[model samples]
Target: MFNQRSSPDKLMRIGNILITPLLVIMAVVGCTPQPRSVDVTTNPTPTKLVPDMRATTTVIPPTETLTPLPPITLDARVAEIEALMTTYEQMDLFSGAVLVAEGGEIIYEKAIGYANREWSILNTLDTRFRVASLSKQFTKILVLQLVEEGKLSLNGTIDLYLPDYTGPGADQITIDHLLKHRSGIVGEPAVQNLERIERDYYTQEKMLELISGFELLFEPGTQWTYSNFGYYLLGVNIERVSGRTYADLMQERICVPAGLTDTFPEVTSDIIERRASGYWFDAERGFIHDSPLDMSFVFGYGHLISTVRDLYLFDIALREGKLLNSSNTNAIYEAEFRPIGDETCEAYVVEDGPASINGFRASSHSYIREDRFVVIVENVRSGGYYLPGVFEVGRNIAAILYGCPYDQPPPHVGD
Candidate 1:
């Protein structure tokens, strides 16, 4: 029985998934101010990747086939995802980047339309985008690492580390609960003070204070709710146990082993050579160009950025057990489901599945599956509201990749 009301903190805003200009600009400045040494390890393992090229620079003559696979052969699945991009781009509905991977191979990779409309900066396969909630997976891995090291225990109460925290359920909430969104913590009120301050520019200490004071929404471990606050606290726990910053942990454990050069925890302004600019749309504000919200509060939960290629590679690594141990991995996946609805209604399933990675339109935005994963990224800010579309885009791509029918639909991810 999943608990419908077991909402985690809202610290994770939607913008984390897609990098907005606001976030990029703020990330650039925020990272600059905090200077820290990052550890870089060299892994001799080499990957069998197709020659990497910028989609923006590559000229696929209009008459040239749009196949992104080997020997220029087109698979029906790849063709459909390509066609969907064409249709969506024509409708002016989507303009970002996407990649679909199966068995650790790129079945399809593309960047459509404009990354930046003004300078005519085209989107590219290497161009970076904010992966909003996608960052949570990284956060979860860090916490699991701490658990493996014996610095923290999943069942250990939160009070073990932060003796001063007096928030409701502080004594009862465990590290496992926080990771699974079962902590029952009501997440936003702690930030009322920083609400006046811009999220990106705020100091880390202030952000912690905001989270430390939130009240409990339900008894610890009662149900599951997607709470950014729970994740943010997990970040704090990492800092406490590792005696290092969150950014440092990410680079050392995840990025280096995966060989993801374009992905990083902080954002900087002087756009990387192949970075895309994000745009927002509104009724009154037709197209507002902005950076991703600088969320110091939810820094660990959703403050990372990466390109589609790197995102795909990282997902593959995690699924293959390159990151965490088997027990921790199982625990991490198990934390996803929280029982919801009444007896007559079905309990919400929270397992990571193939459906979660499908672009934006799909409903379970945060889910990641075992075999195939699709990442649909968008650039337009107004496009943020179309996250569900991103999921659907992934789903459509998945259908083609797995030889499954998109219209036929598969099992519910949560179920």
Candidate 2:
């Protein structure tokens, strides 16, 4: 201030001195250490917050899978069903064999009541029963087999085999008509025409002769009419083409293939031990011990002797296509509706429905419903009050287990 202004060189030297010291102090302050975090809190306790420093690794346990259980065996359920049959045996209501099976495995089997009440011999599983119209299925199979082999066709006429046998409506009928029960030949001349016939000695040829004498009930293929004559003609056709007795053909072709050792086309002295005595109900005859009524008269119509076990085996084997080709097997499974055609026939909607188990003139009906409901009822002894009630009891048991409709059985008459 006293000197006022200085020289340019002197002023520059004084500014450099001041600027060098200030730069040194600024560099020292930037390089010096500082606090990691600064506290900015209004509370009394001021603190720095940080995440947990200790490291951790998460591990999840593996999940365990649950295993499924096995199916119930047929053998396990057999005893429970056998108990139901036992009740009927105790009341003396039913006799003969009953077997229920699935997939070739016997689930329940029993032989109740007497095979021969006169001899006091009880029935066994091997005891045979006359399986009436069921024989038609066998005859049907034999014909179909011939069709498969090209030996015959379903459309072939009867005249192709049976020459010199001329009738008014014979040419109008075809082999297919016979298999389908549509031939409409008049059968049963009277109320029980088949019952009075001596069934012991009639042969296939004789059956044809008998049927040929009858009139045509309706035009062939016009409609179905249950015709034993039609099946008789089929038996004739088989014998004529194969040149083998009907019995031999059935034994070799069907019985052997099905492994039904106890089943046979006829009963003779050799099979006396296996045959069940036939019974009859008449005002004058009373209870009689008749030998197994010969199946000869009905041959291809109503003549088959089989045990329940053998029948079940045959049924499953045929249905499963183990015995025949799949197409042929399916053809047989298609319903054989009655020619008269009633709504009642369609009312029963279950697999393997009512099966006709026959004696001589009398036939028993048994059925195993879907959902595993089984009912086997029969008139082993006719005119006995207990047989009908036994069937009712069987239905009740089936309803309790499977919830199906109960069948009301007729009164059982005593011998």
Candidate 3:
């Protein structure tokens, strides 16, 4: 308090010294660096965490491999065929019975359309139909059987069997020639006259007499022409050599051995059960009753009636060698005999055998190497004409079995 009032000059000097030191302290404090501002938008570096040293290694189990399925079997093929035929039936393109087999086992079977259209009788598996030219196959088999029994010789001339007959080329034509269609006998006349004569019943002798009158188309074995007369002559030879009727021999030697209960020589006059009435396809009328025939006129050429089941049995018998030995079967399949005329002969091989007549069609295919076969019989003539051909149906079925492409039936042309 007493020294509060100091001299002006002295007070000024003290104040200056104090103020200078304070200013220097303030500068030093301001110069010191503060904490830098952080940018919140920038990503910060991740913190590395030390893994636990005591942890065990992680393991992954492997995936399992799956097994593939087996291939399509005969049974499965049967189902496929069933579906296919059902489709055809819905289209009204198929009628009658079809039977397919593999290794002598039935794979597929079906009956479609009507056995008697007028009565609206649906066809059954047991329904019988005329096998038409399929009878030739049976006749051929019978001839081969006769050869085996020493009752006939393939090389023997027709004259050897029918010595009393003296027709043109009959002496020169051999059994083999007739069987192979190499006999140059004219067939057109007989075929053309069938409609006229089909109504009349003829005995074997009378039938031969009628055939003998036809002129030879060419020298024996010089050309090929289908001759029902040739097969008819074979039937006569079978009768003369075996001392049995053709029907009797067929029953004992073929039908009985093959276990074919429904196969027999057709007797037009005899009333038969489950017989299919034949129908012809008319472009305008759809389906009409087939022209009447005596059945006897077709004779050994094509006069047998059978069911698909029976035909299947016959096919099985053939493949199992129950009908003929391997040698004879081989000859039947492999024998090469050419025709003599300019007309090419379409020979029936073992792999494919087809037969057709007025209102009946039958097809048989032997896939011998594969042990598979198929048989199709249609009682209606125009059943397959406008759509799939009768034999084409069999081929299409085969293509399905083999997993191959097949042509579909054409669209129906008529209403």
Q: Give me the candidate number with maximum TM-score.
A: 3
Residue range 265-288, candidate 1, lDDT tens digits = 654334455656666655354566
Clashes of 1: 56
Best by lDDT: 3
Ranking by lDDT: 3, 1, 2
Q: Which of the two candidates, 1 or 2, achieves a greater TM-score against the reference? A: 1
- Which scores better on lDDT, 1 or 2? 1
Q: Is candidate 2 or candidate 3 better by TM-score?
A: 3
How do the predictions measure up, each by TM-score?
0.69, 0.66, 0.76
- What is the per-residue lDDT of model 3 for residues 102-181, given as tens digits with 9 covering 90 to 100? 54455567788877778777888888988877788888999999898888888899888887456788778999998988
Worst 10 residues of 3 by lDDT: 21-30
Q: In candidate 3, residue 359 scores what lDDT?
A: 76
lDDT of each: 0.55, 0.51, 0.65
Candidate 2's displacement at residue 54, Å, is 66
Error of 2 at 222 (Å): 1.0
